[model samples]
Target: MASSSAGIVTGLVAAAFVTIGVLAHQASVTAPADLGPAHATVSPAPGAVKAPRDRRHPDALPAGSGTGERVVYSVDDDRVWLVGPGNKVRHTFAVTPGSVDPAPGAYTVTSRSSRITGSDGVLVEHVVRFTSAGGVAVGFSAAVDDAAAKPDPDRPTGGIRESRADGDAMWEFATIGRPVVVVR
Candidate 1:
């Protein structure tokens, strides 16, 4: 009788473990809430995706301009796109444009400065210069204070302003002679 009781207890413990394992496996593969059969999202790891609404800029270029790894700037929309070698848009973000805009054509990164006072009298970093507009060096930068206000018209500047993090990405991506394509 004791042997039978022991056997029964062992069987129950095994069954409990099997049930727990199955439940954990199911949880790992469970699908997320669904709006409908046509639109259901899986529970992905954190930071795996950008919000659906923000996937692409509303006014973004349908296709990138330059070939190979390069930066594409849209003068009309005040947006910047970093294109990879395969012509994939690695990153896209908005930038505060300066008064002077670059011509709609191809240019190459000419110079870079880690930190400098912008022509607008604002300190900026990650300066990636490609061209000059009316003697003012045109480049991308992030304000030292990390402000995102529109360019100060009174400042009369052509310093394309971006967020500090975006500037960092631009700095790393656009070295000297990297192609910069400006489009209308």
Candidate 2:
């Protein structure tokens, strides 16, 4: 009888332990309540902000200048376009100013010359000079050379001229009467 009583006591203790363990497990398994709205906010790093998307300038010439009067001869990362009228790309090229650098302010084309010398004594003309939106003067010159031989039979033979050096940085097209577009 005593042994049976002892066995009963042992079983009760075991059952109590088991119950305690189950209760503990249940408590541990419960989901945590959602905290109220967070008070502290995190922000992105200084350089993390993405650059603003570039919008197409209204005065900027179209990629193809769709008039059949102009053609897109070359494009650089869609930033600068070399366009010419009458399918003669050799004469005119339109550049979107400040596309490479920020423009100071509104500006206009005061005057243009075919050749100008750099401070380094290198002759680099064939540039369009503009007075900045802030009255500061700036120029954009094409760093291309004319083709060795005239490729287009339609264009005038004498006006299209270029330097003979391979990779010549100076290029000029015959713009005697053609309308050129300049954007700020």
Winner by TM-score: 1
Q: Tens-digit lDDT track for model 1 on 16-61?
A: 9999999999768632222111111112223422222234657444
Model 1 residue 84 lDDT score: 84
lDDT of each residue in 72-180, candidate 2, tens digit only:
2112222323345554333332332221222212222345566655222245456544333222333444333332322243321111122333112223332333222
| Cα RMSD for candidates in order | 19.0, 26.8
What lDDT does candidate 1 reach at residue 16?
100
Superposed model 2: Cα runs more than 4 Å off: 1-79, 87-110, 117-123, 142-171, 174-184
Scored by CA lDDT, what does every candidate get? 0.74, 0.34
lDDT (Cα, 0-100) at 124 in candidate 2: 44
Per-model clash counts, in order, read 0, 5
